[model samples]
Target: MNITPCNTVSLFLPLLFFLILLLIFFITPFKGNHFSLFVFPLSLSTINDKNITTTQVQVQQPHQPNMRIKKMTRLDRVEEGLAEARASIREAIRSMNYTSEKPEYFIPKGSIYRNPHAFHQSHIEMVKRFKVWVYEEGEKPIVHDGPLNNIYAIEGQFIDEMENSIGNNPFKARHPNEAHVFYLPISVANVVRYVYEPIMSKKDYYRDRLQCLVEDYVGVIAHKYPYWNKTNGADHFLLSCHDWVPSFYECNPQLFMNFTRLLCNANTSEGFQPKRDVSIPEVYLPFGKLGPPNLGQSPMNRTILAFFAGGPHGNIRKLLMDHWKDKDSEIQVHEYLPKGQNYTKVMGLSKFCLCPSGYEVASPRIVESIHAGCVPVIISANYYLPFSDVLNWNQFSLEIPVAKITEIKSILQSVSRNEYLKLHMNVLRVRRHFIINRPTKPFDVMHMILHSLWLRRLNFKLTNSQ
Candidate 1:
């Protein structure tokens, strides 16, 4: 319809206002095209003159609890397998038969009175006095001609001959005169430079060699030594002194074998006929003199910590010094004591005694500790203690790991009084196995070795016959 100029102006203004409101809602600067929206943020970055960044995250897989459990199980199985293998090897060696016949010993010509070395002098004197009687009375003697021949030789000629034969002249004719010649010459310089000095220095080479020799020779095979009492038809080699032979064996395995006869202790026959089976002694312990009666009887503290000190092979002494020095300041640490008073009183007074291996181990201290009704604290990585199957170390004493020496305080603190006392009683019950002076002396380790060797010989003969 036709309208006046004022009416037209009012209608037009309302239409214009409606259009502006629509523009503000749909087409404002804030609501721009896609390119403008992205570029607007860059403008702010330019104004601030600083970089802003966003990082994308990677998702990780959730941990499976079964994986850890499987790893632990596998490790446990491996440990069990190793333990079984060790047990089997020990049983085979223990069960084998041994012979008691003393191996024949021969003294080289001109070796009688010329050698002034202590070992040689002793051997020569013994041979002169006892050799005729030994041959006439019963069996042959195991000749131990020390590292000297006649007066002037620094090194024995027989050893040189034996080593040369083995290394250089393999095809040498075995004549009647040289049949018994098995001399092994080892240089004093070599021993001093490579062995004694390195061991004293505490080098890794020392530990490696020691471990290798023990595993290769002493652990696997038995060696012979001269019997001290030769007058009473006792021409057989003594196995009681195996403890003393480790040092020589570790220094040189080939040389040790050349001089010493490889025989089993258990098989040594008292008579010519091979014994079918022989009983072996279970345990052995050696110690110094007994302490005073008063010290042993008094009950201040029933714990005897037997410290094997005074020499270079004093790992136990070091351990005690490092850990229990301050804690046991009140307790007297007797590094040296008279032999008669050491073992008896220490074992009698103490509820538990520490048994640590020296440079070469299985010392008499362990036996004495066992006999005195004191449990042994075995701090050795390898313990050649016989009849380990019957004895449970956990029941008798506490075993502290060498690596965990720092945790000694916590370990001792964790034990209850009742548990400690129970262990003390358990050790006392097994005291019979280590008493050496008795009729069933534990020092009869030699007898067992001889018997085992004899049995092995018999089995070999029987197998050959078949």
Candidate 2:
């Protein structure tokens, strides 16, 4: 119907006003403090102009959540603590001129430590800040208790020390919320003992079964708790001296790719990655003994040049035995020592001890030699020594290639007497780091393992999400 211009203008004006209001509602940002259409998370970056300039810009997320949802979780507090700890460690490294002279404890120095100042400071920071939360999920024998007197002794020792709260235990976190790293105290050696059914003719069957046991354990914990699935076992660590620990990754790679495997068999050939895993020392103690007597002979009194007495298990040891066994009076490589000679005494009398690999890369002989104040001649391929992350093994020991097994005598001969003396002296200095004390004294082998874990944990910064 036809209408006057004034009436048409009024109707048209109302329609236009409604359309404008709709546009404003769609385009205008939310004004409430608790709610926003888009929340901008700012990040700092540098831009190069005529002069360097720093700026903060919003890091846009495609599917941004509501701004009001600020969740400060237990994991966030843990991360913040770790972040502060990390900063303090870095500051200590950059600023601290030397080790603290005031403390009564012995300071790490000399050529044996990679960076004496950095390691010392990092260790100090670890003692001051690092805390580990041991999962109280699994039960005895396999979970908490491990063999205290064997090559895999450190596994049990570490579990006990970390779990203990009696005297000045610095590594144990009082609560899970304060922890920087989580310990999965299951012993792989124990798992093999309890789980694996040895069937005749199938060597690999037990290995597969062992792998399943690990996978099942992970599955149980991951299902029970959010931690494992949160980082896919990145911050969780397991201690195992068994050679089969590496196979856990193979069983379920997605679940364990980032899980830290602290192991004695740090053989690169067996898929041991140093960047992700730790090389623990294999210290063999008989059922109830502490360690071999530190009967170190005087350097001048040590008549034998080098010594070794081990059965041939791998090709490297076989090659070592074949080349040097009874061949040289100075070398003294032996399949078995004669009836009369004392093993520890012979090691003490020798200036250098041969530490050739058996089936696995690590040999207990290395620690034995270190204890005896004898320079270790490491004759193994793809073997990563314990505490290699901190200790400069080259200073106290010699790493001879398998190809050079025949030239071991000439190699020892090549080192001048003065150089030999330096090595021998360094071995004595480094002995404390390898020694396995009952309660775990500072800088001892037990603490060194914790330090290794602490160093690794420092490398990762967990997100706020639990």
Candidate 3:
């Protein structure tokens, strides 16, 4: 109604804005199929309830003839989630400390940790953001089931914990699109039980059968889903205490070179790379029960200077026995303890428990030593201790060379009472990380294993896939 040029311009601008809004609403074709909405948890406690960050992604219609943009697939969505988690964890690590509303049973500190602050922050981020999607491709006993007893128990325990997915298992992913890592839930121990023929004179035959089984399982998953092929098995992982796991690489090296292998036998000489793979504690759960009794003898009460009781299984143990077996009263290195004497009790009584490499680089004795409050005397070559990526083994444990078998007694004797006390105290402090709990408390063996995998995943950039 205004006659001035300014008034005419204002009225025209309003009309043009209305027309543009109408044109966008009616003329633009919706491309719901091309994009998806992603939501990430902001807090560990509020993940299920309310605390979340949602992102709405829009993809232009491909047929528009003007713009060409790739469609967002499940892989991209999953990678987006992982990318955000990686960023958050990096920030958390840089923070040097994390405060939580929920009570913490233990706060990591002291020389036992490589970086107490970084480890603490990384662990908190894992609890809050890490999610694993366990593949359901293979069958039981061979796939889902494993020995929950004796030396190979950790393989089964970890599998069971992941499959249970009840209560507050924050790491279980509801869908593959939200997962940061894919777990290939195939048990190497179970494969040995089902496929291996121990009676067969040719051990290579059994190994071949085992290797083929793993290859076939991975092949099935790789064919069925794009996840494995998308990243070339870099984002997928499998846990095994079986010594045969590393040998499987011989069968299909390309498929496993980048894959995260959670292994008990983290022998560097045997192709165990610390960067890509994870060294897991070999826990011996008698009848699938709780961890071996924590005798936890006081430092002063530990009268024995050094102790080791186990058959010679490998070259290191044989060397250890050759020098110290029945040679000294202070150093009790026996192939077998007397019938009446208890193994756990001897460990509890010792100032230092000698943990030598057996047939494999890993042994339950190291963890048992921790439980008994005895400072672990790690005597092996190329053996990467479990959780060494976070926990500093040298702080709580002594790493004596095999060549120094004769000095084992001298080493233990040389440690001043104050130094012995410090090592003993550190052993107790680091014991929680090696303890295998039923429902897996935080920082326990199970959680530590998961956290190791989480750390490895952080090293990978899934979004930067080819």
Candidate 4:
């Protein structure tokens, strides 16, 4: 095999070309088989095996929707459940019963005593016999003589009128010689008038006046009856409306001693008791008493009407008149019945009662109305009615905002018949929890005052021991 140099070079060039072509073919992607780029010479067996394995994997794999969509859907369901739960809770609260948290201790029966040393013997006797007192403020003998003589007199005038009208005499029979006279300073009277008259009138005044009155009254009283250094005298002041003290105290820092003013505003009648036998003879008056009426004979009508009286400034009168003039036909309206009548029976016969606040704020009428199983329609703007503490307002009554007076008719109309009946039934169910007469007899203001006095005496003794 003799080979020339040119022939040898030509043979090597052809071999290198063939090797390069083979490498290029292997590296290039196959037209219909993607794996051919990595594995040369595509085989039907290998392709079929790979296809089968891939198909099995695709079929066996767990199916899942878009992650974002699934997450969003789950969040939406959670929100929906939370909303439903909140609504259900609110509804449950609305339907729940209300009860008082304070301890129940009522004054003993037959505890009324006539004080032998009372100054106003007749008045003291009346007070001892009945838990009622009437005061004639002025010195003028207008009650003794004049066409309106009976109009202003506390004894013959007011007492006689009450006896004639209401039938029960609250006064007790006592000897005039045994009466004791306790005079309050004119300054105290002036201070009270200054603080309360303006509010009664609903006229704006300097806020300082309230502070001044509270400080002066407290200082004067404290000066007269120095801190016994022994006991807290809960009955020393014997205020009727205990809730008004806070506003006065806030107005004057000097008026309160060791937070005493705050104690005056407490709702609980903790240590207060009624005076056993007041010596004021002229102040005694009779209180009428009425027996409970039969509900079977006098069934409640479809439309119920109720009234609240005893507003110092006649604000209740105005509100009632306004409501009556506007929607009297749509809703039956009635004046507050006299106290001698059976309140429970009257309320039971009615469908709705008008509950108005005093000149300062809400009064006991709301509780009283609910106790009688009547649906109360609240008409005060600043009323802090303790419905949950004693009875649930939502379940028993319709609270109309004071500003929405004009909408009263529509509100009455909008309530479904079933809903109205349900509310009425709820009132009856909740009334058991708010009966003021139970757990204590003589739960009146007089009893409260006497209890407070006794508590004060006990406190004095405790302090001395300490």
Candidate 5:
């Protein structure tokens, strides 16, 4: 039997396609870059950063006999703007003494930063070019609104601070087309407050409901808009300060694999990727209080050597509280504060504040300690420090391993007087970055959090499937 030409050609066509895919999988360093460095020939990309995404701009391949012209969409303009922003940020960051024509209110400096110039320049660049489009799909108390008091305050505070740029946030995109990144304003904290409250005792119900909510939310956005489908939700993000986000994230990992999650429980062990996700400071804003109170004694007046006060919520804290709770007067480790003892005043008096992980890698005491000018001693495993992209934690804080719960006292005492003073002063220097400011000032908490998000945005490019 003679083989037909069509059938023979068809046989080779599938084989050829298989070979091409094999080459793509094995050739590029990004076979499974996992939303980091996805490469494709059809992608319209500017290789300013190490990563790239699909582009619509007509780019002619070198020595090509024919040029393929891809029609530019609204996303192309946004990506191009991001490319320009990346270029500008990279070029400007190299300048050591970047004195702008118009002086900035605050310029990042000192040992606290890896590169003060880079951070300062990048902040300026973000302010100049960055635009975020916050989705207005869901209703209040769950979507747009969040808790602004107690531990989960930052989730609401950041959302509230944005206020959709109503003469408040300069970076809020007026139109979705102008946005470089889309913000899903769903508050996970509020979801637990409302959605999960009915089944408060049921863990599986909470997980299932959360999974459904996430799936439904994504479905709505994907159906209503083309943005999510364009880049597999890479240029999109959601802010959640609840501890459950880490676990809830696991239920629908695929939905979040590409999304930039701004989280407070930034536990690497629980799937927090430093490169793809953002770790925001967890600031505990009291309901009645306007902002974090200024309540720290100067290094000279600080008498207590180390301080820690919190409930034993997780394994790390259980180990911590079990070892040190009410053990020493000078150390002042407390499961609960003594009657009439002010939290801020006690924190202010301490030279070193122990910020142990309680049910999560993040703790409000980290910000609280910084605000009180007490050098924070980070104690946990797989806990990535917030704003670690720009700030040098060692300069202002100490990180003791979870195994060294017993050695905390020795570690704090080992620091020489001068070294202790240096750390204390550095803590004071970085206090501005951790402070929650209304109508956020440059380098304040909101801006610092946004800056981390800005860095994540600048690092990668987006592309379409076609």
Candidate 6:
């Protein structure tokens, strides 16, 4: 009404347009530069009302990363990267590529992987974007170090690797805010060694101590940093191969259930949630030496039908020993390897290696069998095999019910020669994943553990959103 032949009419129009654009940008949340803005399809009748042909309209905005992103916190950038990873992984699943063309990649293939392209893409995303922040609140022995020369070696190995991860794909986050997940660098194996060693005479005394240690560690981190309380420890993780790790849930039921626990004893019946927790392979390292030879004999050379030589610790093994111990000629189940027979050589010579659970649901025999290139015959209930999310255990391994321990021979005999060969070949193909390498390698045990955690974080993020 006031603009009656204004001198600056052209300037006034441009200024009005500028203010409109500014208001739109201010009200809308932009992801990068380009964002979708629907035209809300108008009917032909609505347009024809204004003296033009009416038609429905749908518009898609084009890509344009022109504007600077609003001040993004480190965690914001992390979640953004993860969201992108999830989208790309979904695409990879749809595309169905067996292997990656990326450098230094093994490019997973074969029936060993549940979804070859999805695992491949997810692993690539992990290598590209995954970052970990190891808490510096704890001390050595129980915190920064663990038993490298025992069955719980994986706990120590992973801790050392993260603490010293370097090279093209570094996983260690320089700052907590930049991490997708925070690792509480506590080694339950080390905790048992140091904290429980003094109370070895009083075994029951350590349970309370262990619980307190776990609670104190969480409390300290939650108070010292905003990360733990932020998501109630959902983005935090701990790696432990100890048998006692399952009891950690009792210490702080809520926090333990929230965070990811990478454990060897991933017994579903014993409160190990496969969806949230991870099953890490228990790599046996004995007395400052590697567990077993890197490669075993050929499938043709494996003359022994099946072999097993382990102490009967748990009920499953007791049943195994009861039925098969020194009772069969074709299937050798020894209490001791008859003095002359070596453990590794026996396993290498056997086409199938028996892997029954010991004190815990996890047994080192699975990895040992893998190391020997022998097709593992798992004989345990409620055990979640490591990397089961990506690797199909049925491809390379066989599972016999514990109740049928006496019928182990018949089960081994029933497997056709063609199937045995396939299992053998697959076992060799998957050896790289179980190997513990120095300086780390793609798709190795450590990398697999990291990938498992990465997948869990993606799931966690999606769950939170819903």
Q: Is candidate 3 or candidate 5 better by TM-score?
A: 5
Give the lowest summed-lDDT range of ten residues in model 5: 38-47
What is the alpha-carbon lDDT of model 5 when measured against the actual structure?
Answer: 0.79
Q: Compose the digit string of candidate 3's lDDT tens values, residues 338-457.
A: 779989988899999999989888988898899899998989889988887777787898999988987887777888989989899998888888887777788988899998888776
**Could you tell me which 10 consecutive residues in candidate 6 have the lowest summed lDDT?**
40-49
Expressed as tens digits, the lDDT of each residue in 239-309 for candidate 6 is 99888887777877966757789999989998888767899987788886756765579988888899999
- lDDT tens digits by residue: candidate 2, 304-347: 99999989899998898888888889999888899998999999
Error of 6 at 208 (Å): 0.9
The TM-score values for the models, in the order shown, are 0.37, 0.83, 0.83, 0.37, 0.84, 0.82
lDDT tens digits, residues 1-466, model 4?
9999999999899899999999999999543201011121111112121321110001111245445544433213423433343233233234431122334242111111211111112112223322222222222222111111211112233223322333333321132112111111122223334434655555444455655644554455445543311122221231223233345545643323222211221322321112111111011112321112324112237344434444333475466556664345445444554558665565566666666544534444554565555677877653433312112357677887766665666776787778767767766554433332212223232233322222222121110110
Q: CA shift at 14, candidate 5, in angstroms? A: 38
Model 3 clashing residue pairs (backbone): none
Positional deviation of residue 135's Cα in model 3 after best superposition, in angstroms: 1.0
Q: Against the true structure, candidate 3 has what lDDT?
A: 0.78
Q: State each model's CA lDDT, in order.
A: 0.35, 0.78, 0.78, 0.36, 0.79, 0.79
Residue 25 miss distance in model 4 (angstroms): 86
- Listed per candidate, the RMSD to the true structure in angstroms reads 31.2, 10.3, 8.8, 31.3, 9.2, 11.1
Which one wins by lDDT: 1 or 4? 4
Cα lDDT of model 5 by residue, 1-466, tens digit: 8899998998899899999999988978532212334332111122244455533322222232433986676756766876765555556565465545467877777899877877777788778778888888988877889888898888888788776448768888888888888888888888887887766455635577777787799899989987777667778888888877766568777767678888888888888988788889888888866456788998889999999988898999999888899999878899899999999999999999999888778898998899899999998888878898888899999999999989888888999999998999999899888877777778888888888888877666554323
User: Which of the two, 5 or 6, has more TM-score?
Assistant: 5
Q: Ten consecutive residues with minimal summed lDDT in candidate 1?
A: 457-466
Which of 1 and 3 is ahead in TM-score? 3
